[model samples]
Target: MYRYRITAEIRRDLERIELLRERFDNRGTLPRRWLGRLRRDLEAESVAASTMMEGVRVTVEEVRRLLAGDTPPTVDELSASLVLGYRDAMSYVLRRADEPSFAWHAELVKAIHDRVMGGAFGLDAGRFRTIPVFISDGSDGEPVYTPPAEDLVPDLVDGLAEYLESSKELPAPVVAAFAHVRLAGIHPFKDGNGRTARVVAALAMYRGGYRAPEFTSLEEWWGGHRGEYHTAFDCLGKRWKDSSDVTPFVAAHVAAQRIQADALSLRLATQREIWTAIEDRVE
Candidate 1:
């Protein structure tokens, strides 16, 4: 219930929460000028993080346009404008959508990858894989990792769906963390597993009433922290094998969120200050 016992998982990160609270509380009493500065700084950081997360080059003006309800520019448009590749451009669009669900998850991943790779991307777009595929390290070209057997996909998907359905009863952060770990552990599809997992994590947060936590670009953060992140999954895989026990994974996930929260809080305070200075001069 409440998305796979997330309370237990969150308990592992209490220290991180305390650190975040301390940072947040320390910035509580700023003057109006300082508040303005903080707001601007937060906006800038938000735009920068968002652009990075989307995996495209986007101008501040383009970001403003997208936020203001202008027709979202296509992946090709983003590629040309930002000088990024097709794959990166599509990743940006996939991550930017605020409302994502399980059904939409399949469709978006397939469409984005297809658009990037030139047609119906995965072996199963809306369906789970029915064959076992080896997950190899790009660096080593060896089949070092293998997912569950074909027969187990249905049960795994069912468990995930049930967990998502029960997520409403959980805390926002816990739900987000659990979703990320569980989905990534499932490794549902052969390709786009990581991206799919990140999108699922974001959707869980959106459902839990938090803004999509753009702590870091998923690819940037995960790619940079690949060793640790993979270690967590590998450790769990060896221990749990079939059943999902995402406690360790959740700990890492929440730690990432805590870092993002701290950065965002400080950035917000700085932006508030800058805005106040500009307003005071104008007045």
Candidate 2:
């Protein structure tokens, strides 16, 4: 099983995230229509961010247009396909998050991969890679990281499912962090491993009741800070190994939660002020 110690810093960060989440939840009540608009906007942002992390070149506005049943003339079919696929997978994450019977399983992971990669790149959708895979920098095409042998992919992914099921007692952010890195380390599919890993992390957070966009979506932070995001996995070394400590990745994930939550708080305050101004003008 994958292992990581949740240091004191992580705990404090998690506490801060919880406090911010509490405030957001307790901020009286916004009209359902307004909340719905926010949800749609965040969903578009998440889809764009997650797909863009995998090198898709679609903008958030393009994704929003696509999600709203309009095709942007600037978005090519390939980029549009990737964005719509990710949007479908994220929609699944939101639905499953609300379900009382949701559980971690291999099939569920594969299903998500299918949604993410099935449309854009039909390379082994819903299936683990039968061939070995390596991560390469686009410039040199040299392998930066080599995953486990193809033979081990099945067992490794199954082990991840088992670990997720067993770790239900841990805090949501911690579980989410681990889920992100573990699946990423396993590199289960031929492609879409990163996208699958991210969706899994979101599912973990959502299932743990981190339903707010600020609490659930890290793709925006990750999409913007791609370097820091990849560097967090340096602890895993050049290959997958059981002994690798994942503390750095977990800490980074927690810190991202805090940053995003803080940003959301500020954003909400601005929105509230704008709203008050509009009301005053009307009066």
Candidate 3:
């Protein structure tokens, strides 16, 4: 029962992400050295930020050490699984960006969930939720929002996949945003729903060639604004199942895309200047 109401504001934000995406469409806009700088610690930072949004008490330092094969100080299994699993799954999304073999499907989303929470929570990963759950306001208070029933999750997820496939008329960013909200509203999985929703959004963009030459994580941006993020979710009302407009969530997400795109552009430009100066000194 959800449809993206693309306002003029959303249009502008999609345009913003598209411009940078066009710059990197060729995938060689940046020199190999610059690419190395961008890729150097991007994945770790992105994964760390994403896990943090999932309530993991982990930091980029801990993640970097863990990646370096060092034991993190006081890193528990939950934190470890979230950090590593999301990193692996994020790698898949970025890898599939270049590989044409990956296709949009419901099962593809499930596979990403598997990488996200499979081993972390036994039997709950990769499968749709069989039991009901509640979205919360970080309180033991009454449920904030309840998603569709388990029986409805499969159909709802499939509808989203079908939207991705059939909505060729829509801009990739817009479709990606819709995918993010739709699956999130469905709350398909028992756990990892939030992470999976964000990943699915990334998948839609990366697969659609929506990337800038520099590295940036939409998750990182969202993680930094958890209050605003939840506030947007709260707009769906106690009964998200009722037909309610999602303009607030869509508009805010698209606006954040512009903020991130601008940030990356500035970062890349500064890096370019530094790289040029280094080249001149080297010669």
Question: Best candidate, TM-score-wise?
Answer: 2
lDDT for 280 (candidate 2)? 86
Per-residue lDDT of model 2, residues 1-283, tens digit only: 6568989999999999889878977888885766687778878888888888898888898899999989999998877777887878878878876667877888999989988874544677778888888998778999888888989888878888888888778889999999999899989898889999998998888887787777877888898899999999998888778778999999999899899889878987887787778778989
Pick by lDDT: 1 or 3, better one: 3
Per-structure clash totals for the candidates:
23, 0, 0
Deviating ranges (above 4 Å) for candidate 2: 118-121
lDDT of 3 at 62: 90
Cα lDDT of all candidates, in order? 0.53, 0.85, 0.75
Question: What value does the lDDT take at residue 192 in candidate 2?
Answer: 88
Residue 60, candidate 1: how far off, in angstroms? 11
Candidate whose lDDT is highest: 2
lDDT of 2 at 183: 90
Candidates by TM-score, descending order: 2, 3, 1
Candidate 1 lDDT for residue 281: 95
lDDT (C-alpha) at residue 129 in model 1: 64
Query: Would you estimate the TM-scores of all the predictions?
Result: 0.61, 0.95, 0.90
Writing each residue's lDDT as its tens digit, candidate 1 over 1-283 gives 1123446546656456555555555545667656564444434334434344335555545544543446346434533322222234334444554435434334444444333322333334335566777766668887656666767755665676676676577665666676666655566665545555665565565555554234322433454466776776654443226555666677677766666665566656566677768789989
